[model samples]
Target: MSTLNRISTPLTELTGVEHPIVQTGMGWVAGPRLVTATAEAGALGILASATMSLRELEDAITEVKSRTDKPFGVNLRADAADAEQRVNLLTKYEVKVASFALAPKPELISRLKEHGAVVIPSIGSVRHAEKVAAWGADAVLIQGGEGGGHTGAIPTSLLLPTVAAAVDIPVIAAGGFFDGRGLAAALAYGAVGIGMGTRFLLTSDSAVPEEIKRRYLEFGLDGTVVTAKADGMPHRLLRTEFVQGLEGAGKLAQLLPTLRRTVQFKNMAGQSWLELARDGLAMKRSSGRSWNQMMLAANTPMLLKAGLVDGDTEAGMLASGQVVGVIDELPSCRELVDRIVDEAVVQLKAAAATVRSA
Candidate 1:
């Protein structure tokens, strides 16, 4: 069967999106340009709204609409104080999908659904997937330990199958997926699609500095480390000296500097100190993390904003997936998506032939 034949569902059909692949909504990463490029390339590209101000977020949605008429998704923080406002912007834009960085309330889901948005949340565990599926999430993206940013311990190989078995909704596998073989593997494991983060970040279309992208290319698969110090939650990142230094320093030892950096980040991100602290506290409470962890958690998003938006390497954190090591060249979004789809088709066919021969 053709690779396209392997995935024919409401997701691909209703969205009018061609490929099953998705460019995940990465904070300070996936923006209007990247999202539009992905949608134009036939895959669903999700706008990362967690790092945006409410004004910036709306402008981004407008920018994406200006670029592509194709279907696209907007990634929002479910717990943000302005989440309702974000949802209102999504409805105004008539965005095809709304993906959540944090699990949202059922009422929020209902509100978005009523406005004709398909909801998908990134889940790290089966229980979370089941809960969201029951709550009316159209689908779930399962990112494994190999993913970037805040991630879970289960690898995609294990987690994808588990979540698929536990939930009735479609599962999009993520983490450690960088090539066609991985896409074929995900399909074999019953995932309807694959979501990519670092792979997309390494692409030429990404607005990140060339130096930063090169840094990602230099690593091997083992070069990335999952450190809890970036945020209160364990986050996958490139093993930079900054992260190593923070690791050795006790949480209390890092508090003052973290606070100082938080202020700087607030200014850089166009947020007030009060807003930043409030967001930090909200994040901590939602994650069930402690005060120290919550305070430290500010580092990741702030650093990411600095790196991507301000091009300040010293103050920025590069939250990259393990797949970063394997990506050597930066291809355009169109080239990357087409190559992945074509290669996945070829690979799946070859695997089928081997099974038939066997």
Candidate 2:
């Protein structure tokens, strides 16, 4: 009845999921419906709480529970003003895993683990991975430069093996993973699972508009650009006219819209100016970003909302992985998960045969 036996790994055992694949929490893209579908399809589904208010997050969690009776994870902002409240919400709902885009505080990690939730943080470097493993993170998801949104310079092939060797905990690979061949490759590299964002975003269950999804499908390997102009960080995005304009325009020209989006995000997040400032200060302290970069950081959510939620490609940009070029069709979660698992089985068996012949 379950296809999980096809590929067993630490990730599947820890999360009690049938597969070792993960649907990453992309802001505005990973909502209740998509998360629920991913859960039902046997991969770990992570709800993106960075784009949600406290109440909205709770409701979304409850809705997912109503839809599926499987384990799932919630991705949270470690520096969020309501981080404690959100942790309490997860405890209240008995969510299985708690994920963070940034490294959570040591005390917070302790608190979650004590409450019977597994804590996994997304890291970009080996040192960061080692830091979290030392701090008692249950696992680490490593996303390389080819990943969507904010990313680092190291590619997955290099980053995965380096982090896997440095840390004793389970490693989940992200960036440029789309199918079963990638999964087999990750396992060979010592990763326990693969986390995917752009791949999952193209799924039929995704909340992104069909037209925006179509726009994403038109991309080739060269269709993506990693530019710091979007949010003062290295963000991989589809080469849209809007992003091109942002790249050409000076920082001064981008300031007004950035400020306006900050206000809009504040209202949407139900956070006051003082609260927003405090969060920014905390982010600045933790990340060591410049004041200018911190100011620009506020634009990320609003811009993502425009393209992902409103489907306004001209007004906002699409965050995508370099692997977007090879993906063509929109498959339902079940179809995608099953096909990947089946293909992985074939590939693994073929490799085993080659070993025997050798």
Candidate 3:
């Protein structure tokens, strides 16, 4: 099937985007280049800002705007010290959507919505989805445990339906989604669209290191593990030797190393210590994590940056989805999105034919 073939679904119109697929806001992974490309290719491309400085975030927004005229969103930590700055940038830029990494405050949602920006927060449970929908969020992205980074315990098969049945607003199913079959299945479950993180991270447009991306392709479906060691919350990541070591490092010994690592990262990134601490505290409070847990929470992104940017797999963590093993090659954003849509259309039509004959 031609990759351009698309599924006729509400997602195409609801988000005012061309496709029913979304490239989720992956911290440090999804940047201006990838976001703009995904948006231009007809999917919601969200700029991941949780790992960026306020200035870096604004520059990224500008970068994406420079690349594509299509509608795109910025993913922000709703509880950041500079959240106001990020929100202001979004409003000033007239960003079409604002996706929260964590459940943002109602006022934050209202503030962004007041500026004509649609609010969509990724949810891990039925309650989370329902609560946000009731709060007047434009939509919710329901992610399963199989998703990368910080994720909830619910499976997509169970969580998607639960959230869809409970909320009146749109829900975009995420986690374990790689191709059209997943999209068709999500739509069948009443989801307007499918959100993807690992799938996009493995794409040609993704700036992740070539070797690291290759490692993702080599792993199998069972290659991932969910661990709380990175942050206070559970996160999905590839089970590498370093990850195993980190996991075994236990909570006590991890603090000093993590702090040292964070300080080094700040230096490398040229961030002030005060700014780092401010962002860290904001992240901790937002996630309901303790101060110590917040300090530990800095490990995951640092690990990811180590592997993705520094070519040091042993020095960092590699957060990836379970779908990483199933992905064998890196295709351009257009090619990847088109292929999945076309494949889904063919699959749905074939199923329809079977029903008709029956």
Ranking by TM-score: 2, 3, 1
- For model 3, residues 232-320, the per-residue Cα lDDT tens digits are 67888889998888678866788788888778768755778898788777776567788877777666667778887776888888888
- Kindly state the number of residue pairs that clash in model 1: 0
**How does residue 205 of candidate 3 score in lDDT?**
92
Candidate 3: residue 197 Cα off by (Å) = 0.8
lDDT of 2 by residue, 100-211 (tens): 9999989989999988999999999988999999999999999989899899999999999999999999999999999999999999999999999999999999989999
* Per-model TM-score versus the true fold: 0.94, 0.98, 0.94
Clashes of 3: 2
Q: Candidate 3: what lDDT?
A: 0.85
Give the Cα RMSD of candidate 1. 2.5
Better of 2 and 3 by TM-score: 2
lDDT of 1: 0.84
